[model samples]
Target: MDRRVLFATLILLAGGATGVGVALFAFVGVDDATTETTVVWESEPAAGDDGSGAAVATVDGDPLLLRPAVENGSRVVRATVAGGDETTWTVPISGPDAERGGGDANGSDGDPSGVSGLTTGTLGGDPVAALTTAPGELVVVDAADGTERFAVDIGGPGGLRPAIGDLTGDGTPEVAAVGTDGSVRVVDGEGDSVTEASLSGDIDRRPLVVEPDAEAGERGGIAVMTTTGDPATVHLLDETGEARWTTTPNVNPYSWNAADSRDGSVLVLGGTSGNIEAVETGDGSDRYEVGLQDLPVEVGDADPGTVYVGGSGSVWAVDLLDGEVVWKQQYGASTRINEPGVGDTDGDGELAPVVVNRAGEVLAMTQRGKVTARGGPDAVVYGGPLFADVTGDGGDEVIVVADDGTAIAADT
Candidate 1:
């Protein structure tokens, strides 16, 4: 997906609201609560390491998406937040002297040059934005003026945005990031010290912010991937960065996108083990498993009982309710898919699954995965297709990011 759209998807789960309901479904879905998420307090997921990867949660209320881009020679946060007045802010991507929650920013650590991830959430009762920059730096910005507040020196650079939440049930939000060394670091919005917790394996993707449900009361924890064994492990960290429970599911999870089921009981997640499966979110137990005709790249739910999965050259609809293959269609477009957009691209009032390929191709398909509209650019697409009414012409447009960092909106 365009780095910005990817950030939006990945960052929306920053506050530990819930697993990306869609991805947990396939890669990331918007239905965490409905699927019945489990906190995984003490058990280890069943084990089997075969795995690959997937998408993130895109914010729904943001007026415009902000992507970090280049301007002149420095890195800038490019924003389309305003309808017309597009804005750019030059980020201080140099140096590592800002204090972290527990340490001073030292420039001698990891690559901390360019900004890679951008996400915003409320911290200390104020609007706060965070970026994971190259050379190992976590810079917290005040969204009001883009002022640099916290610049901590981490050792490795990752594009995963920090997940923010009230991890301690202290009525304030805290930001959590997976350390390059397989550790979880959490810093309160107002503190200067971090609560670092180590996991069993290396941290694979960004940690997921799981929200509290009726079953639990203190607060939900962060769901992080620690791939040490073959099937890998999913560790549930409580508010204080303590491991509450760990489980190894049947498949090794690759993509961070996990969608919640409609009943809010399970998560649909991508398994590199050549299968798409559902697991109990709270305990990491396998609920169901299904084979895949192609490697899945994007996953979501069209409706209850129906899950939409986009792969390298095909899309499949799995009937989790009945454990049957609803429909699977192949469209030889490219190698992988960005997040799929489900909307009425045909202007027929019927929703179609729109997928953007790495080749800059957009395909609008029917509910049964039948192709409808196909259009895109000549260059490589850097992000997934975003379905929006950019022109306000009563028609939806497929917006994609080019490899050159340009947002290209194509009409369906």
Candidate 2:
């Protein structure tokens, strides 16, 4: 199916580890190398109380506003829609130290209490969709949003754009953004700049991906990507901004995607290997592996310990502790899912991989829609299941983009 997940789309599932035993796509047999299945899923309406709609926004006719942006001092700044109106709103990101860094997000060192004039932009051509942060500074506002929430100039003298990840596992996330000048910067949670490493003299180079280690002590560990001639190099960085480990493509790494298991193990996509590779988060050593005959469309971990793979119109669950296969499901053949993002949908006390499909029931103008709800096939239908209540409530609510360009919310 032309709908097979594509690497050019940057599909990434951000959690867990596991080996194979179960198959992900119904047709792919666990023991048969030639086995291939066409897995598809039923589409359901976006979850909400009345189905009238949830929160929504749009740039032109996009149907959804940019991803939610978390301002350092302000809560979560999301593009919101209500009663046929669209504008951004500040939903309090409640928690301890929520307002640690406040200033012009541009690093103007403006104010240290709050941010203002929040706006939007683009990163490496990818739309700066959203932003978030851990406990301290190292603010990660949507570079797309020009607002200053703990603004501190990054990327040498020209400033820079950064990607944020929970590198230290301190329960707090850090800024692991690549500089526009080809440097990598690691900043404190408080927006205080830390170490900046020169990536190479090539200004046109971009760090394909940056992810934190899952191991408790390896919280500050990071994984990065760079290009050499035509070959791409992937490097693992420690909390100290040192290159702890690096690797080259065995074949042709199409798109760079990385995620971590609870034990600090990492899974990387887009290597010459043509299969997903697992590596030690601490030293970036080779670990177990899995091969998706078709390039891995997307990868995610459900409970912080198992890795999930979606491709060839199916899903595969792998164990992180030992790389065992848990289960596999082939939902649809023609409906390929993209942007394999994960978060708990049913609020069943666990987060699962969520995807946008165009086959069975869920219908977005683009198969790149969204799936909320959890469980194998019986999970309760909830609204857009993105992240945890990241807002403040004990549980997270569903957020979805209605076809009419409005944001909708429903308690799960």
TM for every model, in the order presented, reads 0.67, 0.54
Relative to the true structure, candidate 1 reaches a TM of: 0.67
Give the runs in model 2 whose Cα sits over 4 Å from its true position. 1-78, 81-147, 156-161, 165-173, 201-219, 249-251, 254-263, 270-274, 358-412
Kindly report which residue stretches of model 1 are placed more than 4 angstroms away from their true locations once superposed.
Answer: 1-62, 81-85, 95-114, 120-129, 142-145, 149-157, 164-174, 188-195, 215-219, 294-307, 319-324, 341-352, 365-372, 387-389, 393-396
Count of backbone collisions within predicted model 2: 76
lDDT of each: 0.52, 0.40
Stretch of 10 with least lDDT, candidate 1: 45-54
For candidate 1, the per-residue lDDT at 378 reads 59
The residue-level lDDT of candidate 2 at 350 comes to: 54
lDDT of 1 by residue, 1-412 (tens): 2221111211112113222122222222121122211111111110110000111112343334445544555555544532234443435456333222211011011222244445567786667677665445666776655567787754454445566766655567777776656756777775465567776666646676665555443346777777676677777777667777777765556444444444443555565544566765566666666656434445544554566766776666666543355555544444565546677655667667777666767766667554556656654553455555555556555556555444556665
For candidate 2, write residues 1-412 as lDDT tens digits.
Answer: 2343222322222222254122232222212221221112122232111111122223333323333233454444454422224444444433333232322222122212221222233322322332323232223343333244454444532212245555655555555555334466665555666666776533222232334434354444555655553565667766677787776644344433455565665645533323555666566566665555444344433456666555545555556655555544444464443334455444556555544332212211111122223222222221222332423445443343332212334333
* Residue 177, candidate 1: C-alpha displacement in angstroms: 1.4
